[model samples]
Target chain A: MAQGGGRVQRAAVIGCGTVGASWAALFLVHGLDVTATDPAEGAEERLRAFVEGARAQLAGFGLTGSGRLRFVPRVPEALDGAEFVQENAPETEALKRALLAEIDRLLPPQVLVASSTSALLRSAIVADCARPERVLVAHPFNPPHLVPLVEIVAGDAATAARAAAFYRGLGRRPVILRREMPGHIANRLASALYREAVNLVAEGVASVADIDAALCHGPGLRWAAMGPHMTYHLGGGAGGIAHYLAHLGPSQERRWASLGNPALTPEVQAAIVAGVAEEAAGLSVAELEARRDRALVGILKARETVAPDPAQDGTAEE
Target chain B: MAQGGGRVQRAAVIGCGTVGASWAALFLVHGLDVTATDPAEGAEERLRAFVEGARAQLAGFGLTGSGRLRFVPRVPEALDGAEFVQENAPETEALKRALLAEIDRLLPPQVLVASSTSALLRSAIVADCARPERVLVAHPFNPPHLVPLVEIVAGDAATAARAAAFYRGLGRRPVILRREMPGHIANRLASALYREAVNLVAEGVASVADIDAALCHGPGLRWAAMGPHMTYHLGGGAGGIAHYLAHLGPSQERRWASLGNPALTPEVQAAIVAGVAEEAAGLSVAELEARRDRALVGILKARETVAPDPAQDGTAEE
Candidate 1:
């Protein structure tokens, strides 16, 4: 993963909404010229604001690199001479097919197109392309400037490797999806948790505020470092994940039986909003996000040193 | 929310495993007297290491508060003079029931006993206890030091208020589960995601590294800050969750219909493990955890300032 202008030189972000804007910012901050586009009338302004927000966040990370960005009025303009095209168009399947087809026809054959769909499959998403092999899913987290994960699901196995190299060029940790599943991996897990939380609150067993609190405080914390299987590995001492699973497998199975999402009902919906509302009792979304980003900045800065070696520092033990 | 000595000043932890040690360390770091008991002979050494690990984490957060911690030989001894007892015993109902019985016999009526059970229900686990009112589930994350969430499911709703305050006092975000379910909130969601990841790989759709990579790069990034519902909320702009749901609900449901986590067969298990192992490359479990925690520490520190606020940061969009 060479940091300098190695393989990926310039990038194209073919949308300017939450996901697209984030992708563009990451590319620009990593020193790649970004050409972002959207059909919306106010996309330029939104893109600019979005870029500023992302830059604010990247600057917090110390702006280790630099690049330029331009917002064009048209799609072809945005895709101008780009080596890679990241599509953050609407989630509609038809829209993606049409968009990919257009990019495929216009952009050079060597340019790869990445989709930022949360739920759609890469094969399903790229089925219509003449060069579908070059199109894959390069889905990133919302506000990619802060969070560290970028999932690269190959439309085909070959595309997966190419996507990995591209994301690596941007200094992002790209986890590949061997197989495609709805909601990919994390979202499905999150949705499951959320559904149950709603169910609990809906059933009057607890409040929405409480359910979120449980996760944000409990597993959410541990998960910030390791997944449940890996955590259990440590929980099992030398027994490792397999041993922990073997011992706790029955319990895990029993637990899994009861894991389902809560039905979204009127009362339940009200409760959830109110509960989360209370949890966010004093801060606005922007304020919370600001606070979140600020803390994230400090966290990432600290991580630059302490994070790469948690065990030696006793940071990983308990 | 007042940071003062007038708050509760005592805590107790039983079964000093990773979770228990984290609980004890946190309780002590927050200026509470924590008495920890474990039948394991190496408990002291482990506890010291765990405490030190937690202390370093707490120190990073600038929490200068201190609390007393003593290793008691017996469960009752650990519970003695403790206002709150965090039960981190193994995830066994039988073991928990037996321990609760003994704890009920010794602890006064007012003392709260919170079990750190990952997926167990409070009622079933506390069924054998005579004074079940004082016993509830206050499950924390694996390395409780880094994460700030605490799921406080009141066994009978009797301990709800106290559990909330106690956890909040420890600088944790406490979520209440209106009802008991497997994996609480985060794990349930997590399982949903992991299950699908497993299913996909088992079916030969993709590889393990690719699946993990997809998540790490995609939804995992968003989840690290704003979760799915909220992410969708923003996606919908001012429309909020209801608006987003109204429009995308069917599609989301369509995605949900295909989300499956089948029983792990021998073949599936081998494939899943092999996939993850290949993903692991050459890193050991401990090494992986250390890397995870260190990275998490940085992420968390950066996000610390992004505290959830509701007043000025209106969350109606969620």
Candidate 2:
């Protein structure tokens, strides 16, 4: 709804689970009054703790949105005076449809509503809404506050453009999809890669630890700085993407042909679990999360040095 | 081959291409007396320049090995007193076979020879060698000195173990494959993902820039620290990888079913070229490479802060 900083003062975060809490913290850090609603027990306490945890990370990136956060138990009250709403409810189709429809009916037509659905389609989620044009899928990766991607799939061009601008203002990379697709773009690519990764483990081509190391040390390093297309473009030497398709296309096709589609049988599942155990080497999830977040902060800062924030760069061309 | 440090003092680098030059620099940085041989014109000057350029990156990693670098014009002369030989010749079977055979005849039995072939198989490449056991594939990602991954695919256990130990001593993550397949492990996984990325571009689902952003901001960051298996393990919540498989396996399969197999048509190629031009925004290939290397150095340093180097950890368990 709001183009720049002055117009959008208040934002509502529906469903204060892990994803919702992250959204709430991010909104507050972006200097928006975040009214977060979650019906779960202890949701308020958890949200507070999550926000406090995210404060250090935001500070690491030198972000201080300085907005107020208010906890509410009812959705209607949360959306009373909010200009933007980010819904992170359960993944059930019926639940998301009903919840989105209720939000659409209660919120004003001008206010935009976004659902953080990783797998669900935006069309299906907003099918029952009174004004579906304003409702879209604004899926973020896990740990929404840290990760910069926000996949925006809108029913109308104006909604997508506005949402893109809003996210850009917050220093997030919002990818607008030309059409609605399941799992959006990132998950589909990840699923494709993971399928082969599973197949390799099941086929005894490589160990789980080795497979993971292969990625993290090899292409994953490149992927951190650039995507598959850009990496290939670089791979083409000075000739760029066209040279790659012409010369290495056949080799890629051969590799694709040999790509595995292994069944995730009981045996495969056991192998993966055992492999992860060895890889973890007694490190708890919390320990791993801290390590991951530290690395993320460093990488985000590194990227910023190379490609400064669009808001700061004054080159906000989508 | 010798296990640990003192015994393996001399190393030989065959071929003076980009991969060969990087291998030369890495070996030299690990304190190996490197004798690099390449017959091409101006090979010595090019090799010296490449090594000088990599010096800053190696220094950033706190590496300073006092090893002498000698340039030789003939392969036999380079291998005369070398303990290890890393071959980086062209991918032609006839050239690799003849070159490897010559090295096998010249070097002693204890000397280990590794090929830097990415797409070609070790089995096929070493089919004509006198002693294939000592010859294996030690594929490195592009710019081998920066990226730490080296996919070791050896025919026998001892050869693979020795190669792993050598790479480990050089501060590299060498993953020993259980079985050799096309593109090995990393490239196969990359190819699987890239196929879908190409398909998305062909289908008009998203732009090239957004596709890259989705990955770099999302899974790519996680990938830089941990592999897919570990990321999914965390995604599984407190249940770890086991819980994830039981609940989310079906969803992954569904996503897999929808993965595309698009042809690398000319139109698709043109679109990528145009999109990359826009994404590049007037940055040259050399400029992008420098930015990538700088970011990589920062990420590598950040990772070291949390997970200390395995050499320092003294628990080199692959």
Per-residue lDDT tens digits for candidate 2, residues A1-318, read 352434578999999987999888888888888999999999999999999999879987778878998998899999989988999998889999999999999987888899999989988889899999999999998888988899999998878988887777777788999998899999998899999999999989988888998999999887887888878877887887788889999888878888888888899999999988887878887787777778777777765222222343433323
**TM-scores across all candidates?**
0.84, 0.95
- CA deviation > 4 Å runs, candidate 1: A1-8, A64-68, A124-128, A153-158, A179-182, A261-299, A304-318, B1-11, B62-68, B76-80, B155-158, B280-289, B305-318
- Measured by TM-score, the strongest candidate is 2
Candidate 2 off by > 4 Å: A1-5, A304-318, B1-5, B304-318
lDDT at position A39, candidate 1: 90
The count of residue-pair clashes in candidate 2 stands at 1
Q: In terms of TM-score, how similar is model 1 to the real structure?
A: 0.84
* B211-311: candidate 1 lDDT, tens digit per residue: 55444444444445554444454445455555665676666566666666667666766665565555556677777767767766776765542235323
lDDT of each: 0.67, 0.85
Which candidate leads the pack in lDDT?
Answer: 2
